[model samples]
Target: MQLAIGISACLLGQKVRYDGGHKASEFCLSQLQPYVRYQAVCPENAIGLGTPRPAIRLMKKTQGDIHLVQVSDASIDHTDAMHQFTEQALPAMSALAGFIVCAKSPSCGMERVRLFNEQGHQLGKAGVGLFTRQLMQRYPWLPVEEDGRLHDPMLWENFITRIFACHDYQQLCREGFSVGALVAFHSRYKFLVMAHSPSAYRELGRLVAQAKLFEPEELKQRYLQDLMHALKQACSRKTHANVLQHLQGFFKKHLSSKERQELSSLIDRFRLGHLPLMAPITLLLHHLSRFEHPYLAAQTYLQPFPEALGLRG
Candidate 1:
């Protein structure tokens, strides 16, 4: 099934911006669109703010509260309307695997958006967008990224990995919650979690070990919260090398001295930034193909997303 992803309407090439222009993402349109279904939304427009509507800004009051108001008139507040819109929109959004938002927007920016005081004095860029803030608070596990941040290779790869993992979990839910299914899901992700966070991997292992002790619903919620939290950590080259080494150990009995040495060298080169991650991973996969181990073969770490994205490079 195509993963369902939520996106800011403007980012999806809809002309719903305050100036009636779209901030279309070429990557989203050309590369990702084929793999997933997008549910586009323009919160401002959904609240009856028409195309070419007056621009809005986040204004902080003396009471230490932020409000979305017209750029020209602070008295013209739309905070209530935006909140209502978000409340209504969140239920349907529960099924989304991820969300892509416009950066620096009063309604959609993920972080570091400009802020103003009641008198319009510039405040530091510390305020989150009202709508995006709520979206995140409601779905803490959902992978949310701003359009600009998606340009960074590591961040892009991380976000894509997360959404694919989330989609898999959603499928597990649809298949009905069972202790065996939960254990299997965690087993597939074992190496992936280790790559991101060794500590989290351990924590998740413990949770999975105790899966049957808790209610099915409780176990699902707790496992997802911890799983998503672990994946959010940045996977450094050092961490990747560690995980790769652990994976290489699986082939110790099968690989000759020359094959083992070659694999180790490739991993070292990757750790030293001389090669992309795909180099070592490709060789390991080739070895796995030659010698089948069901556990190693089932790991999602080896092929987290479609290889066509070439994200590891």
Candidate 2:
């Protein structure tokens, strides 16, 4: 899958700032690099703010109005400039399935950024960065996260998984649906959903079963929406565990006793915290692939892009 991901330029180790420093994210650049197509951007710099320029801050008026203002001179309203930069860049970012922003910058912060009163006293928590807010508003389904959150293995995996799933959904969006294809797609994401919500698997199966009643276009739209929503809602760990347990159902007819035992052991190890969920999932997918069944072979879930993100353009 050719997935586009927007990244904070500094995080990608680009020295495109006034301070001549980069806040490079090693994991994102090294680990995720192979899997996604990155479009690194720096809104402030891209908006013609020269390096060494006065820093910008979110400021609040006495009337409770908040605005991103210049720290060096309170008189400057840089909102229009930032907005224009975002608008001009929209076309470039349209293909992105997700984004990773620096945690707290006036131009890219995703949440909990500081806002100050006119007197320069810290007031309270404020909204997201100018560019990040606009991006989310435009593409509500795009998976977005802060660089700091990537340190947590679960969240990191979730973020990456969502992006790739979105890519899968994009393919599904174009080609429409098939019962077998849907099942195979679900199979690939079994462990991920299991980590979030178990009951969702049953619900997804129901959707696929009922799909025959609708036209291909209608079914495609409806099922894709449900599929993506289920994934979004199942992002919690408890929800995922539930989905994982239910996935074992698909293997009932396909696996030998020893294979099932090995997979079961892996699942138990994962549940006991002795192994990563991916360990068990790897085994399940391996066996799933061994099936000579055509439906199983057509499953995009099994090979939803390898470790390479393909972003180096």
Candidate 3:
């Protein structure tokens, strides 16, 4: 099945913004739209706020007390209504692999949204959007990103990697849960976990080792939470180089001195930032195809997402 993703309606070119204009993302529209199914949401619109409605802002009433209110008139609060809508909407969104939310929106921003004091003074950017906060609190494992942050290549790649991984796990769950299947899933993602965090890699290994002790539901929740948390760490060039070298060990017996030197050179060049990640990865994949190592072939690290996305470059 194609992966399902939750996205802000405006990002999908829907004119659902407060001003009756859309914050359409070309990347989401032209590039990512083809690969996955999108579930578009407009929280403000869902809560009976009509098009061209009065804009809203998050106002801090006291410590741990914030309200979503009209920007021009603070007394018109929508926090309760937004909460009610989110409580109703999120249950249906449990199947989504990821979410893309508009940045700096009072209703949908993921982080650093503008906050206001009672006197109308700027309280700096420290608030999370009302709807998004609940969405995260309910489903901490789901991959969520702000639309603007996707412009950064590293963040973009990381988010894509996460959603694909999430979808893989979701598929595994749908196939039915088993300890052996869980182990196989972890085996496929072993190198990927190591690339992001060596410590998490080891921890996850122990978790899977003791999987039989926990109930199946508990095991699924714990494994997914830990796995998603580990993936959130960005893999550095240094880390990628290390993983590449580890992968090189698999082909050591199959390669000639010349072939080994060539692969090592490509990895070294990539580590020094002279080449994109795809350079060494391509070489590794080529070697894997020729050598036919079942372990290496099973790994998702080799091709995390659809190659057509060209995200590695």
lDDT of 2 by residue, 1-313 (tens): 5678899999999886557777899877888887678889998888788876777888878887667798878778788898998988877775677899998887788998888888888866766788888888876667889999888766675676677778877776557567667666666665544444557666776777776677777766566556555556535434434544555667879888987788777777776677765676677667766765554445433343464542211
- The lDDT ranking, best first, is 3, 1, 2
Candidate 1 residue-wise lDDT, 83-124, digit = tens = 999999999999899999999998999999999998899898
**Which 10 consecutive residues of model 2 have the lowest summed lDDT?**
304-313
Instruction: Return the candidate ranking by TM-score, descending.
Output: 1, 3, 2
Per-residue lDDT for 139-220 in model 3, tens only?
9999999999999988999999999999999999999989999999999999999999989999999999999999999999
| TM-score of decoy 1 | 0.98
- 1 or 2: which has the higher TM-score? 1
- Which runs in model 2 stand beyond 4 Å of their true positions? 174-195, 199-229, 233-245, 250-265, 282-313
For model 3, the local distance difference test gives 0.94
TM-score of 3: 0.98
- Give me the displacement of residue 145 in model 2, in angstroms: 1.2
Shift in Å, residue 19, candidate 3: 0.8
RMSD in angstroms, candidate 2? 4.7
